[model samples]
Target: MTELKKQISASLRKDLEAGELILPSLPEVAMKIQEEVKKKSSTAHSIAKVIMLDPGLTAHFLKVANSPLYRTQNSVQGLPEAIGLIGINSVLNMALTYTMRTMFVNTEGPWKKVLIHQWNEATELAAIVAVLADYLPNFNSDHMMVAAMLQNIGALPLINHLQHFPGLEQEEVETLVEENATKAGLALVKLWGLGKSFEDVIKARHDWMYESTPELDTTDLITIARYHYMKDKQRLEDCPPTSEIAAFRHLEELDFTAEMSMQWIDSAREKIRAIKRMLCM
Candidate 1:
């Protein structure tokens, strides 16, 4: 790397390691929902009660219930109806993901352009990963969805630093520092008390070899989700080959060409678009 890049990375690493950078906290609703979900005795009615306290979240849940993903026999016009149509777990995860997305919408900085792009990419990837659970056995779509949404959260503080510090600008050095975002994000999420599965997905998602375990994991979802994003941008040059994605390599065996991949993204885009509209409204 260049001298300036090296210096920026070193400086960021030092600050991050020394706890000088303040990472953003998970949204309160997400925390509360997680707590509620973890309780073995919690029921749909109980979770809905906490969620109903947040008008925006309740609205989003109702909207998602009406989304094509669920494809209900009829429209869902209320929280109780949504909960009934889409199971408690599914609605809970959607609410949690929407809360995180809303949390970062107000961010501004030198990295705002980068951050928005990354967020959109992540949101789309999260939706894709969630849907992939239908085809990929033993995969936890909820974990993958949340992992894809949050894997780059470390960049939030980095963006704040760049905005507050006049010395930093969008240069090659800054770009390299951006690449270190994943590491910073993993650390921040751990600090926020995220589960081990999400951390594993964040850590291994971009690796060349899909770690072979007894079951499907978030890494596989992230790998495929990223590919979907790149495919949308026609950004083959920006990513590793299909061989790098364990899932993609296998899909290739089933005659999944690049064109077919983009088509899949088209399907994913509809899901993402619907979700984004539902959340925003």
Candidate 2:
């Protein structure tokens, strides 16, 4: 197993350095939405026109606009209205949110089951952070949601090659995922033109005891989310408590605490559940 791990790791790094690895392009809808958003002339109605092209995305947009997470006195009814309810900045995030789920669900090849696990893990982390972001005034929850989803995106480039390996154990697969995720993620994020937020998330996702700055950042939030993700899976048997995490200390300046974290998660259970359902569907 160790030999296979080394062999696979070496091959992947060679391909990465040589720019031979195939990375996924952002979905057309997401790309189009991003372009449209950069235009100072863009409006909810115009954004609606772009989203209306995909029936699935259109439906998901409406559902999100009406979900307990965003809905208020009036239920969102149409694409333009949905875009209005969520704000233009979040429309691209919404488009991304839908397409990522679609990509994960609609995957092909021998590693379908393994890929699905990765999909669920990433999105679940996204959901946790989105809810947690509600506690902070400066951060955007939708943006944080997307950041968490992409934190482990490094694992994606390897899934294709892993399918070719015979008798790869689950433990071996998990090990390889940990070994190459950050490097592979950086390559994909750059290729896709995902920008700085993604670069930061991939770079810091594994810094379990990171202490770079006393100030809180998007990286710190995802770190906290990653810890929660591990804890929820009972994978923290050997890990330290949340209070010990450097990120948690910064969170205190935001009036967030280990106790507040649990309470907020519990209070916003419906919103998180809604997001998970939307992403998986």
Candidate 3:
């Protein structure tokens, strides 16, 4: 790393560790949904009522709920029915994901393209995670989707800061953003009180080959999902095949083969596309 990168990285780490990082604040609706989701007594009706208060969000939720992705034989007419179809966990993820989506700075900013690129990449990985998790009955695809959606969150603050450093080429900007993203990401996850599990997933984003317990976990699913996403994007520079990936090796229940991987993606393509459409909307 250059001196500039080293200094920024060290400063970010220190600030985050000290709980002094200037993490972005969550909007009130996002905060309310997050708090409501944490309550044991929270229900679809109650959460729906809260969501209903925001006319715009209500419209968006209903649109997403009725979209082909979540559509069923019966149409979803309101928040309560939407929640019923999409589930409470997904409702929470939707709110959080929406929160991230709204963080995009004004369109005129120099970093707009970078922000959109990173955000779309995150959502695409999230779509992949959602579909991949569908194959394993034990995993909640909704939770995994949220985990994957947050993988690039650290880049947000880096992009925000880049507005001040304009003459740097895109490559230098990318290096700066990636090098300091983890520190910002860790602080954001904690600041948002998203739970320790999320914190673990955030840390694991950098460890593509990390392996843990014999049983599979959110982190393992994310590692595999990210690897596949990279492969699909043709961005997997030196990443090994599934046979050589630790997460793939560790998650024995998958028994994933190269051919099986391709087959799974093929079958899940529509579901994945629908999810990406919903998210991008």
Off by over 4 Å in 1: 1-6, 140-142, 171-177, 210-215, 249-269, 276-281
Instruction: Rank candidates by TM-score, best first.
Output: 2, 3, 1
lDDT of 2 by residue, 4-50 (tens): 87788788788878888777788888889989998999999998898
Model 2 scores a TM of 0.91
| TM-score for each of the candidates | 0.82, 0.91, 0.88
lDDT of 1 by residue, 1-281 (tens): 55655676778788777877777777787778878878888777888888888887887777767776666787778677677776766655686667666756788656677667667767777777766665556665655677787766666777766675545456652574356676777777787787676677667645656554433356655777777767667987877877666766655665555456556556666666765454331
lDDT of 3 by residue, 70-118 (tens): 6778777878888888888788777776677677533336767777887
- Top candidate on TM-score is 2
Model 2: ten consecutive residues of lowest lDDT: 205-214
Better of 2 and 3 by lDDT: 2
Q: Which run of 10 residues does model 3 get worst, by summed lDDT? A: 104-113
C-alpha lDDT of residue 86 in model 3? 84
Q: What's each prediction's clash count? A: 0, 1, 0
Error of 3 at 41 (Å): 3.7
How close to the true structure is residue 263 of candidate 2, measured as C-alpha lDDT? 81
